[model samples]
Target: MDVSQVLRMNGGDRDYSYSNNSFLQRKVISMTKPIIDDALANLYLDMNHPKNLIMADLGCSSGPNTLLVASELIKSIDKIRLKLGSDELPEIQFYLNDLPHNDFNTIFHYVSKFQKNLRNQMLSNSSPTCYVSGVPGSFYNRLFPRKSIHFVYSSYSLMWLSQVPEMVNTNKGNIYMSTTSPPSVIKAYHEQFQNDFFTFLKCRAEEVVSGGCMVLTILGRQSDDPCSKECCYVWDLLATSLNDMVSEGLIEEEKLDSFNIPQYTPSPKVSNEVEKEGSFVIDRLEVSEVNWDASTDHNLNLSGEHEQGYNMGKCMRAVAEPLVLSHFGESVIEEVFKRYTNNIKVSMSKEKTTLVNVTVSMTRKG
Candidate 1:
């Protein structure tokens, strides 16, 4: 399967759209704001005064978060400019990137409103001319000209491999690596991530200018064990849901065995790929756990887990609906997620599980 085509989140601003269900991503973006501010402050301090700045938000799937992030960068820079009292403002270029199947049209459609709000907010000062363009393609390949970008930020991406591993029957009855998966299956997943991340680093090394910074947030694991409950429980539960459907004859057993999610929850050691490729230096690697449901910030229903589990199901459906449709067809989605919700309730009741998030900050060598 072509991951670029099928790996997109559900688009548009509907109930199940990524736009609505992306509170977790929103929290990730907020958590990285200080890192971004530091990167921008350091960018200005490290280089001679420049008249233009180019930044790229990799895998910038369509949503309000897209503009929220852009605004955050602009606001951070505005603070710097105010502090420095600089009359000469640098022109800013924002390359909003994603795959061909992403909802670029919706993003573009909202740009007018976004621009107007930006202008209104910055009316008191000289704001940089912000140009937003959509670049459609995979970041695993080169997406920008040599030394073209100044700051690069990506979040909740980079876990997806370019393609699924080409092995057969290694992880039967499951869609992703679980505790029950064999060593061979785990080895294949790690090898694929090593290659993909190296390529991503090498490509960015060429595109990002000297002294530039890249602040990335990736989904990862807490334990060295690849199959630990912290790393694989969510997917394992999903696979269990699929298996239940197959037992009920709602889905094909053969299809369940063949499907594999082309994502890996990497350890911080995964950054060794950067040292291996030798283009950038890792500035900082930090790990934090986020609630599986962003709404848990308020209260978690550990007793029955109805609302929380239902929210988790909606979130998963927003991200996984397309992939399931591409491979398993549309017939089983409702039932699969129905069972997935119930399974999440039982599992959450048993254990209050959280997602492991890894944030990495890096800088390109001069």
Candidate 2:
């Protein structure tokens, strides 16, 4: 998995595609800070030891979210270090893991900035000398040494698996997301999601130390039903736009038909699978039901086709533009992005309740 190749496929830009707007994602990460603090507090209180604990942020994208999360974790470790009366702080090693196509340079820049800030924070005292590292590979395989990581955190990145289901590709369109489609398409997607999720859990368990705690957060749905229109609105809109392009002969229908984002929604069933893995026991699990008004839509685009009036949209474009352009062509790319913006505006104006259920789960290895 060459880094360049991965970036080429994922639209190259490693920055947050939609981070310009202070949308729910930024808000969610902020609101969840106390949650991480509480979890770390409990881990320090209950775990065998705390002073030298290790922490890693798996699938940390290059943006404010990663930096903020890392800072919080460092603070938690500092607090615990003081309580133990140990001069030695935990060795904070951050694993900025993403697909090969991830912007490692941006992540590296942020890691350096974070380290510099940490250095400044501990000018007078012996602070935990944080070691920053980058892991440019899929989380589906060995990401670190066995039992090496003590505290692992990943946010908003795991729901997208490595690839979508082959069965969905067999269909001319993503019938699973279509408003008028058979129930089986949804069932197939649900099954594929389960498979991908279990694989993710098993892989992480192998890397995490026994008694290690991982705070895993992802974009999920509150409903167990796979056919929930609210949960699939973004996908539906994109698919519809692609169909429009296809009908207009902008791009081949086959190209649109074969494309799919490797995504999955979590449910209690997936939680049960985590428990069954025998490596992780769920310590905490909660879903934040989030909805936002139009005022929060962070639109930063000033142009025609690249314009996405939402911060999240812009950030997403950075991540997806290269691939979209190559696959859909320049003209189609503009049209699709325009349609995406229009769809988002419609969703916002109609007070459409776009369901983005965040599942914050803490698991400890056996």
Candidate 3:
């Protein structure tokens, strides 16, 4: 599918833009903030007191969430400099990276505002010179110079494989790894994930300095089984939505059969295996559950389950619509998400649905 040319979050600041629908991502970033803070502190301890610090946020899609990790990083380092009684803060160079098709302009538009906000928060002398630039490319390949970055961070990314490995004709009416998928389909997905993840680590290893740190938060599976419900149910429901449309003659059945998402939720065991093969020391790897409706605020006393489902549907559409539109015709986008929203509401009414996210903290091997 030429994923790099086609894949991107829904752009601009509309209701369906990734910027508006990225509450779950924001929550994950917030949840991992303390861990990231500690990792940065340790990274500073390990760094040889450099005059400049380079940091990159890989898969940094546009929106308010794009600069979030970078902002927090600068704050963390600033705190460390203050504690050490340093007269000068290191020059901080922030690199935001994503696939070529990502909305870099949206991110660039906010850079000045981000810098101004930072200036307002810190003293003139204490404020480090922060240079922000966009690097548009895939992270699975080399994106930065060797030993150039001090800290690397990615959130709600890495689950997306470079592309869907081998078309699945055997698995009918399903779009992702499901229990109904054949053994070959499962094997293909696992192998693709291993290769992509290994390449990702290798590329970062070359870019990050010795003793530098990396923090990654990826959509993952709680169970070692590749077709675990925690990972596959969402796709299953999405497939169901497509099938419903097919039955209604809105979308062709053949179109549904040929489409599959280029995403894999690896188990922690898989992550450990890949880490061992890469040039990094795994400091911490943990899986946490994030509810589908985690982003919704119940305090507002909104229109109950349907509203929450609609919001969650928007979140999924923000991330998946572009891909779906590329495969299926654009005419079906609204109906697909409408059905998806109903499916989500129905599932939420029955029980809680959550996805497992894996957060890995690592240091470059010396």
Candidate 4:
């Protein structure tokens, strides 16, 4: 697979083959609200000088979802300031980062809208100045001023490596690796995922101020059994379905082997590696086994779900369209998506719909 063609959108999931945007937002808000609240309690941030804190939202996709999370964090900062009895709060430099292809115009517009609300609120003279900028490029590389950030947060982003792992290509069809899975492939990808992830931390360790905190919400599974695809079966299911299409001539075989999705999940090993790097210390590890109410009206779901649905489709096209067209001709993609959509609808027919789960880790590095 020519993985290079797959552009990483901000830092969100790369293999969302069955995504639905609205659904994803609701689910994410429900799941992360508490995590955000807890991070505030754990970090002891004060609003008296909220401006001194520089915070970032990595892989902040376009839409109300990113703003929703940002608003909660802003509120927490405000609450902390009110408690500190400060006449003037410090400015908060907000970095909204994502893949270069993300909807920055819309994000910029949203930030402007948020700013308007802040001004309209008649905030005290001490309210923090919010600085928003778009960091377009790979999170695998440095994304901001060194040692400038005070707190870093990423929701459902870190699980994806900069690109797909090399092992899947080398191992052919016999490999499945993620954060929590069989020890070997999990260990292999862990080694790789950690290497990339630790490099992220190490860079942040340099960029983050002393005593700074970082909170990340990532997808994960509970069992150690590597082959247990329960947590991250979406990709495997899509892959198998694609392979079947190839076998039956529903799609060309050449296109089948040439496509790879850039999505991944993290294991405890990711945290372990961060700690071993000697710059970051784990403060909390919380995993949520969230099950999608497949029965619920899909319209009520969250940004996470849309991402899942889209990657399962939107992103798949963005990444795989060229390969499919080049290998099987452009005329085949429409038919491909139609069948793909049908496959997803059919897969959701059970009484219960479940996903692997998400793991959130709160850490501090000095």
The best candidate by TM-score is: 3
The local distance difference test score of each candidate is: 0.84, 0.63, 0.86, 0.59
lDDT tens digits, residue span 1-366, model 4: 333334433223333221223344347556766667666655654322543667888877666566666666777766665676645555667888877766677667768788767655534544447778788766777888777776788876676667556543333432244333334445566566767877877777777766677778776666665445665565555556666677787765655554544455655555577667778777767766555443133555446544333333453353344444544566666766556554554565543446554544455544
Q: List the residue pairs that clash in candidate 1.
A: none
lDDT of 2 by residue, 81-151 (tens): 57766556666666667766565665566666777777677523764577777787777677788777777
User: Could you give candidate 3's per-residue lDDT for residues 258-360 as a string of tens digits?
Assistant: 8888999987785575556779888888888889897664445668543757788888889989989999978988889888878987887789899898888
TM-score of each prediction = 0.95, 0.84, 0.95, 0.78
Identify the candidate with maximal lDDT.
Answer: 3
Ranking of all predicted structures according to TM-score, beginning with the best and ending with the worst: 3, 1, 2, 4
Query: Candidate 1, residues 1-366: lDDT per residue as tens digits?
Result: 889879898999998898877877888788777877888888876766567889899999988889888888887877776677666667889999999999999899998888788877773466458999999999999999999999999998899899998774458887888877877888898889888998999899999999999999889987898888887888888899999888898888988888999998887877787789998888888888887767333444344544666677777888888988899888878888888878886776677878888888889998
- Candidate 1 residue runs with Cα over 4 Å from true position: 295-306
Look at candidate 3 and give me any clashing residue pairs: none
- Candidate 3 residues lying further than 4 Å off, grouped into runs, are 123-125, 167-169, 297-301, 304-306
Candidate 2's TM-score: 0.84
Q: Which stretches of candidate 2 lie over 4 Å from their true place?
A: 1-24, 47-49, 83-88, 119-126, 292-309
Better of 1 and 4 by lDDT: 1
Q: Using alpha carbons, what is the TM-score of model 1?
A: 0.95
Candidate 1, residue 42: lDDT? 82
In candidate 4 the C-alpha lDDT for residue 273 amounts to: 70
- The list of candidate 4 runs beyond 4 A from truth reads 1-5, 9-22, 41-50, 118-128, 168-188, 293-330, 361-363
